[model samples]
Target: MTACKNEQLFNPDIRLATLDDLTALVALEELAFNYDRLSRRSFRRAIMSDGSVLLIAVGAQGLLGYALLHLRQGTRLARLYSLAVASFARGFGIGIRLLKACEQKAINTGKTLLRLEVSALNQVAITLYQKMDYREFGYYHAYYEDQSDAIRMQKPLRHMSVEQSSHPLPWLAQRTPFTCGPVSLQMVLSAFNPNYQATPEDELDIWREATTIFMTAGHGGCHPMGLALAAQKRGLSAKVWLSQEGPLFVDSVRDQLKKAVIERVHYSFMKQCKTEDIPVHYSVMPLAQLITAFDSGALAIILISTFRMDGKKSPHWVVMSGYDEHCILVHDPDFEEKDPNQSPLDCQYMPIARDEFEKMSRFGQRRLQATVVLRAN
Candidate 1:
């Protein structure tokens, strides 16, 4: 393989991988991981794919280590798909250099955050990631081919300047499985009125006030209009954005009675919105518009498909707080589990790409898009 011109200042041999290095990459993968190793074909594709960046460290002898970063389509998040160093090269600081190179590549591509999953048992890598400011946000059970658990970690790359700020919104974990909407609303409301106490009681109150009776499963999700009305009830000015102007979530229910209940609840919300003279837009609100609203001090509660974050195809709500050219930051009120080590802040100020935000800002087979913008009157 030809020497890369942009060599590392310290090593003078680290650079982007080319297709010519596929054989070495395969060898390195085999050496580094006995299980969950990338196949030769996968390494070849990664080397050639525009959606990925593979950085390799070389020596006079040949390949020493490599880091592979995968850019998620339509998202500002980049995943460090793999990182490995030859067993002989372990103590030479090659891993850190490869990681830094991957982070730089991600930032150059306008990515704001770098995330990865490492086996929980990999203490050395975990310590290195922590030292580099990567924080564990969550974990995946049996993530590996060998049924090993992996810890999800993330580090912010851009939007770190003091000028880049998130709204002073407090994150509240949903007390119940179906209270994400209410909890998100509570967080935004608390941002407006610091005296507003966001409690589990209030969460259920809001849910009762707003739920559509049935989602894709038990205990219906909140309708955007219902959420808007709930915010209004709490003395906040609200606007509702809907992609379609009909009963929401009705299509997800198979039982006629359940469908009718959902439709009735949705129409009831529409009537309340009308009676209160709330502005309901029957079109998709552009991300730019939502950003503008956020910039103007409006708190946004948005409905999104959880499929991107987790593999679940369910609708969920998150409170949008800030935005930049690279990402839209929000406080997600739902945590999959309660861990003493994981703080609510871990879920707050989470950066999501504008494009991915748009794709995720909808749910279900009908692809329903909805948002509730609120501000203190």
Candidate 2:
């Protein structure tokens, strides 16, 4: 076991994720975001998948934070999918430590660039990236349903070696999977940092201008809260078509809505896309029935929980956006979620996958599941 350099050592014990790590990872997700909004199944898949690069930070209690990287070999850039540090330890340098670990992995694999997107309003991340020599490229408007802009940033690994950073990374002698225990709910929920990209007022503005929007009230609790914020922004009426399970504990869903309409279903599916707020004036069907839905979308979902990084269950929220065949997206919103103040012109998006499009239909999960035609003006 090659040890990290003395300067690089925060003494953070690190390792790859394995089957046994699923419970811990899930707990971490729950802590990092509202559990009402995360998918445990996705965590399981990510920990066990070939494409996933999962790294953990071990300290006094257990795990302090984790970094998940998605590698696309064809491109030299490794996407920093998600990174989360327990709330108690923020500013203690845990995030920078884990980030170094990821950069080392990228360099070891011969990757040249690391690309990541943060909420345009995330000054902390932006400052960190800038300090790390990451350059800003562009912004995606309404990249998120909450209608926040995504600030894309990149760091060139060619010029910066893993050793060049103040922190040193340990070498893995023989790559082995890690295992841990389930995290506590207290640890999961208490670790959130609500530094959303835009101000509450900005969120209200985007919501007001939106004529069409999407929701995932059940999968991740963010949708419902997002809907409420959207409604407040636009002064437009908002509605939620949830599965029969009732409301999420994410935000105050009980009365946040002018109308908390329920859209019951036969089974509880992940990321089901049902509309709300629009009227059912059509002879054909309602608007809630026509939009496309899925178990997960390409955008990030938050997870909240309480468990130490090493113990494997801590309070925190995470953000997840992309997934593959067996897994859905999951992530930590350690900071506020992606920004929600971009223009509708920036809202255009195609399905991340065409196959998933068909699969989502088979599962009855589309954003516009039902098409309703109103009386012509």
Candidate 3:
């Protein structure tokens, strides 16, 4: 299904995939592949996820093909997760149209490279990729569910040479989805003290100590003051800065009892901080002030909404590894890339634009901003 004849360049209208296109895209997924298919659930998430780009091609006959791209946040590379055309529509130029659109979108979004892996058995697709200027870079053994190999190919989205940037911190991926708070803590601690080894057990322990069980979606996530207290108990001096007082993530919970429990936890955390003399500032830390604090030799564990990354309206934590005038460098513990060749460094000290960071730093209708600042005693 990869090869297309140059039969008079069939053009199709392309647009971003939406919820309305879900059923069509799902049917198209079924029509396209036998193994390693994207499910209906995956399509829904990608449609809503901020980290993904899903595009659909529409011709006079309807959805001819679609392409899904994974936008690597903080990196210049974008991965073509999937591309499919209707079985009857394969020989037309639909795949070419979808792929070129992907390249243009990648370039528009600051990605300099578009990478994909095609089954080595499918020389047609590999030929299409090559015709589009994609070069073979690597290969994966048994990369497919059917134990078939894949040939990795990539094409520069832009024609210019751009240098890559790396973060200044040792990187570690969060073992569980809910452990980003602790994983960020673990990374910052590794920077603070080299001999301090991080473990999965410790990650769960810190999560248990800090989680508020606020959201009913899957699991309760860590609280700001709770995270600060957990780290403080571990001997690092800690302070909690918040946008508003009382409780955090109260808006995320629906049941009355759960909200009350969150409030109770917040009160207890405040009282405990008072008793322990740990500083809890009842104000949002301005960017300038945060820069000053960072310059004073402190690492920050900050809360941001996943809406900007995964299109999910929930809280996620990342370490503020460093910052410059234009971009804020961070170590996001939640690494979602599944490609084996992609390294953990992909998410380490990733550069997010300053203005975009400011927008992503807040969550929910109240725009809650919170951070746990850690320092040497």
Candidate 4:
């Protein structure tokens, strides 16, 4: 599938569907699906429902994709009602983007379970959903009137309850500047509040005892858990940085990575770099600190991405490692976001040697960029 022009999917534009969007939405839907699909009138009613949500994706070129969410208020269950992408923009990851937007909406509304039904015949979509960790619950025989079987899938968001659960948000205690290689890095961790510290005996070890932690880097979700568990097996402390994404999204990811060897660390920031108070043991410096720390210590790096980054453009994650006469060393988690030809595997962490660093720096310096950090909170 060919994605639309760059300007069509690169813009940070998303909002709830309004009556004003009916004309454009109806047209797109009619063109993308068969007539048996819900009529415009039905679409209008769903949009107006209190427990339902409709999200529209738009770029400079206009409508790209739309997602409909059916949420059962008061209960923690949600469903992907429908999703459609503009015919011209099939390959640009619009479906996943719409799905993510719907997931975020469901989480924001306090839903803990997100489910969906996909046509069994659609192998492409089935593969994408499976790769995203949507488990098949069952199948409805010939559920579609057109003689198509339906695959029922579900994703649970247990960790999303962290905010509502008795558990509190993790906080930073103190940062001690340490050297990894030729660079200076600091370790960050959660600290007890002054009033809450009933006993001065509570030490870094107490806060470092993160029963659960989330990581949101490009590759963090896919691999760090293994390293973290290995380190924990050796009796080492580990923490992860989580992005403020949907609970279902985050929890689904955790389910895939959780192992007996490691425990989770609470860094307490969705946008890790933006948070000024970096957690103890958690370093904000990316590649520079990682290369240094990994060389001397076991600092595990997690790379994450919804898609591959385009080398022709600036990346989402950029870190300064060490500059030498020949080249620079860096680790880029957002490389997938920059690559236009991104796939599920591209979300993993990528290491750039000294030679490649100079090439990217020169490319990034010439590009204008901005980041819209979505906080799950």
Relative to the true structure, how large is the alpha-carbon lDDT of every model? 0.82, 0.41, 0.80, 0.45
Model 1 segments beyond 4 Å from truth?
1-111, 114-165, 338-343
Residue lDDT tens for model 3, 165-194? 333467789888788998988887787788
Q: What TM-score does structure 4 among the candidates reach?
A: 0.41
For candidate 2, the TM-score is 0.40
Report the alpha-carbon TM-score of model 1 versus the true structure: 0.64
List the candidate 4 regions with Cα displacement exceeding 4 Å: 1-4, 158-377
Q: Best candidate, lDDT-wise?
A: 1
Tens digits of per-residue lDDT, candidate 2, 43-116, equal 56657765558888866566677888766422244777777776655676777878888999987875666777
For model 3, the local distance difference test gives 0.80
- Kindly report which residue stretches of model 3 are placed more than 4 angstroms away from their true locations once superposed: 1-70, 73-107, 111-167, 337-343
Give the winner by lDDT: 1 or 2.
Answer: 1
What is the model-wide C-alpha lDDT for candidate 2? 0.41
Question: Tens-digit lDDT track for model 4 on 1-377?
Answer: 12445756755367888888888888898887773475678678877877678898887668887888876432345778677888766777777877778878877876666778889988878987887778886677877768788888877554532111011212221221111110100111111122333122332222233212333322222122222332233234544433222121233233455421223232222233234322223223344544455444333323322122232321223223223332332333222243222221112112232334323332122221111111111
Error of 2 at 288 (Å): 53
Top TM-score model: 1
The true-versus-predicted C-alpha distance at residue 207 of model 2, in Å, is: 39
Better of 3 and 4 by lDDT: 3
Order by TM-score, highest first: 1, 3, 4, 2
